[model samples]
Target: MMNEIDLTKVDLEKPFMAGLMDGMPGGFFVYRGDETKKIIYANQKLLDIFDCDTWDEFVELTGGTFIGMVYARDRMIVHDYVRRARESGRTSGVTNYRIHTKKGVFKYVQNYANFVNDYVEGGLVYVFIAAARSTHDRLTGLPSMLNFLD
Candidate 1:
């Protein structure tokens, strides 16, 4: 088996990290672990998923926490998961939740976040890969029976 990676020892540059993250199958973003958890980097796919044409727009729209986009009922789940992961020193975890899109609609989203620290000048950062694959009615945003099949 491969040895566990020491996250503190990884020294990846932003350019290299971006190149790797951009090719991921879904949206990708990095956010600092501060009071706001400010967005530090967002890949092109993430911008498209958020209906943002540019990074600046995404930053302005999210107001630092992507948690703002989550459905109110599901927001706590995200927070709890993050808290648990941080406590356990986990490198990654998957969270499923709903997000309110800019088009005034909601989409079920799955987020895979990897925790990293000191990757840059920031303290702690989370790199998230997210995908929207809700088995809901495209029009109503309500879960269909088919959602169970997924």
Candidate 2:
């Protein structure tokens, strides 16, 4: 079936994605509507990244819109990628432009996400670790945990 969003239910209501979002390795955020993707839910880790303790402060970051916090150049790409995945009902992944955290300063991170479903309209998801750990050779950025020399 072609999954579609019912905008009426996807407005500024707090999405139904609180619990699952809390478990992601990095952080998670959920915004509603297009004009101002007003953040309805953001996991604690995300709040910690920005030192934000409340949803109201986070929502204001959008100036009121449903776009992600990724770099400007990446928004359209992310949107297109998400739309395609939603249409096919086949899961997809992306190398998202992630605004990351350093010791205290923020940096951009390349991350991945596997979508779950339309928590409202755009869909809720379990975002993965931004910089995944490698267990492989220093020679290559590959998983080597399964095979290594003693």
Candidate 3:
């Protein structure tokens, strides 16, 4: 029989969780699930993705908010999508959008988010972000071979 670990007893700020987040390939972050959507935590990879050298710089660039991290043109659509998904009782979903980095370059990113109720924060969204690579040919707009293998 497998022993089930109790999440309620786990401390998220512990080294194990911190190390895991830091070692992850892509970016990971957590934000409040409120109108402000204030950022609570961000891994180093996330700072790199935003072309920021430190957490302070990242916060300054993004105004410490999730919506601020998104490209202005894509914010409304992304927000609507998340709201709709949550309203439909979905706990997690993926959103493809663009982000205006601190370097002023817009990069397409795929954001995977999980909506959960936290014991301390009430509502929170844990997110993983990665560069969005096209699985289709740009010119012909056809699916690539990698798509078929999946």
Q: Could you tell me every candidate's TM-score relative to the true structure? A: 0.70, 0.49, 0.81
Q: Give one digit per residue, the lDDT tens place, for model 2 in 4-76.
A: 9675665443454454466567766555533454555567777656445666654455342335465465578
- Runs off by more than 4 Å, candidate 1: 1-20, 119-122, 135-150
After superposing candidate 3 on the true structure, give the runs of residues whose Cα lies further than 4 Å from its correct spot. Answer: 1-10, 134-150
lDDT of 3 by residue, 1-150 (tens): 999978778788898788879899999999999898999999999999999999999999999999999989889999899989988999999988878898988787999999999898899999999999655554685665775565
Candidate maximizing TM-score: 3
Choose 2 or 3, whichever is better by TM-score.
3
Q: Note the Cα lDDT for every prediction shown.
A: 0.72, 0.54, 0.90
Best by lDDT: 3
TM-score of 1: 0.70
The candidates, ranked best first by lDDT, are 3, 1, 2
| lDDT score, candidate 3, position 45 | 96
Counted clashes in each candidate structure: 0, 7, 0
How many steric overlaps does candidate 1 have?
A: 0
RMSD of each: 5.4, 9.5, 4.3
Which of candidates 1 and 2 reaches a greater TM-score? 1
Candidate 1 residue 130 Cα shift, in angstroms, is 3.2
Tens digit per residue, CA lDDT, model 1, 68-145? 656788889889988998899887888788776556566677887776667556665655656656657767867876
lDDT of 2: 0.54
